[model samples]
Target: MSILSDDIPALILIDIQKGFEDISSWGTERNNPEAEENARILLNLWRSKDFPIFHIQHCSSEPESLLNESNHGNDFKDIVSPLVGETIVKKNVNSAFIGTNLRKLLDTENISKVVIVGLTTDHCVSTTARMAGNYGYETYVVSDATATFDKVGVDGQLFSAQLMHETALASIHEEFGLVVSTKEIAQQIN
Candidate 1:
């Protein structure tokens, strides 16, 4: 009943890490509470259907990086858990497919479309969506499933966090990918 695609789509979650909530980084002003809420919604949908879900965590060897240590960087809370047979991917870059077995996993599952959700819309979310589109996968970016902080422009203008959020939603919705609400997505598979 999915209006988007019925070809077995996988929910691709990117960078929903504990470190991101720290809010002192560049994302502090851009990250929205809605991202966390939407992620939980997506998680519920995936669990209800027992569909393919892949959680991508970011990691780096650099001493000061956000996801440097295994113990601190690799833990996803109860709010996010791997289903019985779901895959977990650890990535260093924004693109979930880069340096990960994501492509192979999708191919193995015969998933031609991806329902993407998670944090920092301007960074990882946007990057992965662009990559997915370029890779020829039918991509759908959940509009409320992503968030970011407010940023200042070169002209000394400060952008509203909500506006930035809308821009990200606009950037992908019906352009690079289809943007749907969580309710719409849930009803499709419910």
Candidate 2:
């Protein structure tokens, strides 16, 4: 059940921004209200060990978008905000690696494994997980530490937030990374 080893895994948090607080802007409703708290748990662990931690902030292109660089919503949520000396990678697209130096930073640090936790499981979180796997990193997506909102399908049927969240994790699990809980990560490190 251990997801880690002698090599320390970098903690990659994707888009845990204040913009996500606006459910209307993102979707109908979001699943896992405790996502930030759970991420905070893992973040503290990483900080305790002085492991590599990357905070990926999404900078939306739309000027009116909540995640736009000039908006206060673009700032990281207080629960899991980065401290001094932490690596902060700002990206415009879904994947943190796209149009950012995330890959280069990982390569420079010689990090072979990554533990990802953040907002919108079906979007940025999923995209980053997929890319991390493709990049040959041993990726682990924390299930309880990432979430998504309900969406209307093409047929106009409403999909539940919980359903969307679970499905996103499913797609990432095995293929992209191992979907685990915050507890699983803590157990491994402890």
Candidate 3:
């Protein structure tokens, strides 16, 4: 069955920034080398279709964080940068709706379904997807358009980045939202 409806869904891109490129600084192995490229393709498709697009920028409150506004890493990746008129939601937390007016904006526009794609699949993207589902929006997470890094478990065991990414998606699927591929979403929207 198609996860997407006939009604067009708004595109919400979360935290696709230069900060994610600093692998050494992040101190972890990463997966999905083509995430950015896949995100770019979706962004271009959304723009071409004149769909509502929102760019979520993470402005970390911590001074040492790479996403701090004062750092160059806070800048959006060139390929998925918000255009002059597209809405840019600045957030300090994982969920874009927490401190931002994203929910209100969507409400005003009558946007009930959202197609999400972006950085770290486990963090911001997953948080947003969960919240979106709870808020009654039919949310779809594009798996290939998001990536994450290896993490140390509570027991101090390291997990592969790919495993973490897939697990994150699996955890959200059929509960928070549907996990689809970039190609699947592209076909649905196009």
Give the local distance difference test score of model 1: 0.77
What is every candidate's alpha-carbon RMSD to the true fold? Answer: 2.3, 0.9, 1.2
lDDT of 3 by residue, 1-190 (tens): 3645566689999999999899877647899999989999999998999999999999999888899999989999998988999999999999999999999999999998898999889999999999999999999999999999988889999999999999999989999889989999889877
TM-score of 2: 0.98
Off by more than 4 A, model 1: 1-5, 27-31, 70-74, 154-156
Pairs of residues clashing in candidate 1: 29-149, 29-150, 30-148, 30-149, 30-150, 31-148, 31-149
Candidate 1 structure quality by residue, lDDT tens digits, 40-115: 8888777777778898887866767666755464456456756666788888888888899999989888888898
Relative to the unseen true structure, what is the C-alpha lDDT of residue 99 in candidate 1, on a scale of 0 to 100?
Answer: 91
How do the predictions measure up, each by TM-score?
0.87, 0.98, 0.96
Task: Judge candidate 3 against the unseen true structure and give its global Cα lDDT, from 0 to 1.
Answer: 0.91
Residue 63 lDDT in candidate 1: 65
Summing lDDT over every window of 10 consecutive residues in candidate 2, give the lowest-scoring window: 1-10
Residue-level lDDT for 95 in candidate 3: 97
Could you tell me which residue pairs clash in candidate 3? none
Q: Comparing candidate 1 with candidate 3, which one achieves the higher lDDT?
A: 3
